[model samples]
Target: MQNTPPRSRIEIDRLRKIFLAEGREVVAVDDASFRIDDGEFVALLGPSGCGKSTILNMVATLIAPNGGAIRVDDAPVVPGRPIAQVGYVFQKDTLFPWRTVEGNIGYALELAGVPTGERKTRVAEAIHQAGLDGFDRFYPASLSGGMRQRVSLMRTLIARPEILLMDEPFGALDTHTKLDMHSVLLSLWERERQTVLFVTHDLGEALTLADRIILMSARPGRVKADFKVDFPRPRDAVKLRETPQYAELFSKVWHSLGEEFAKGRSA
Candidate 1:
């Protein structure tokens, strides 16, 4: 029997978050709202401390909002109960040091009671897809930063989550490594087109990956601007920067984001 299609649409309405920091009531996000269509790749961009990660956490049902609401597939998000269809890739690779590459990637399948033979087969396929064909037995400590991140990504994707939330997953990699990871990610995303909500501070990375870019303001974050990226698919993350259209959009986004940066510094 064929599987049912995923209803991964995300809707955020007047979302609010407040934190108690150093005996002060700090407002992180204020009346922020946005939507991410099913199977669409959207990037959330903003200055530091602008609640980008906070919003992702709320959508994942990892945290409760101070006010307002977030819905996934028209269902209200309930804290403490993670959505089964959602998968998150945090900033750190958080791989198990004791597990080998294949062991790590197949951990979820193993947890789900998949038989040994089937688990191994699926793990092998994940390893190949991640370009880690020969490093199946290698541990995370023995791998480079990028290679370890690849393992982390495959581990998440192998679970077949319909919605993927990434929080600056490549922020630590060098330029060359980051670009290579972008290529790998685009290739994987094209295959399944899982609904993606990526949080990043890098303008270039946002431009290269997202179908739409959502910019948030400084602290007490709000939706500052929304941009549609019309570049054709199969984008070369490095080469796309050299195009005139890319330059123009970059300038436009920078102008809006730069203002927020200045505001953040002043406040």
Candidate 2:
């Protein structure tokens, strides 16, 4: 008997979506399909309002698509209940103002009815993993923007999901803070080995963090190009940006993206 090959961690097939906008029909994602292997860091890169978030949300099962199918770990998704299989980190910090860092991190476990002892152990590990050990008692307002985002990240990580869906989680931060968070996130990803589907508008961020970059079209987004990073793993953000290969790849991706951007403006 022959053994079957390993299945993909994520499989999206013929995904489609349409929206009714002010008496006009809008097709957001059309026949978009992609697959991700376990432990791969992949970025969905495109312009604003390009339906990347729409795709992410559909994959998360936060919204059901008009057509096609999504599967995670070879199992079909049950709509309205994607939480257990996937961890999502949105662009905005959705921390409860009333909850402290520890409270927020522990909330997921609480809702899931995890035992008190387990919650404590998981929250502590998440805080330490996110580098927020000393600020467990700090409220969101008391922390810096980066710190708050770190807390948000920990909240997601504590849930221990196999897949991570992030939508420009660092876009709101300043350049320096963004760079720091990138390093932190990369380290965490390397350690955790979760299959991450990251959405970002920043070209450098996509290149720096992703094992593969999926470039999408302007408005009704579709995959335009997918490039594998030839650079060695355990990448250094600052140093990688300085390399000749990095410059070449950046220019190629930018030119491919520029055409769609200009076309978007024209339409």
Across 160-223, the per-residue lDDT of candidate 2 in tens digits comes to 8889999999999999999989988988888888999999999999999998999889878888
lDDT of 1 at 257: 97
Index of the highest-TM-score prediction: 1
Report RMSD (Å) for each prediction in the order shown: 3.2, 1.9
Off by over 4 Å in 1: 1-8
Where does the lowest 10-residue lDDT sum fall in candidate 1?
3-12
- lDDT at residue 37 of model 1 (Cα atoms): 84
Residue clash pairs of candidate 2: none
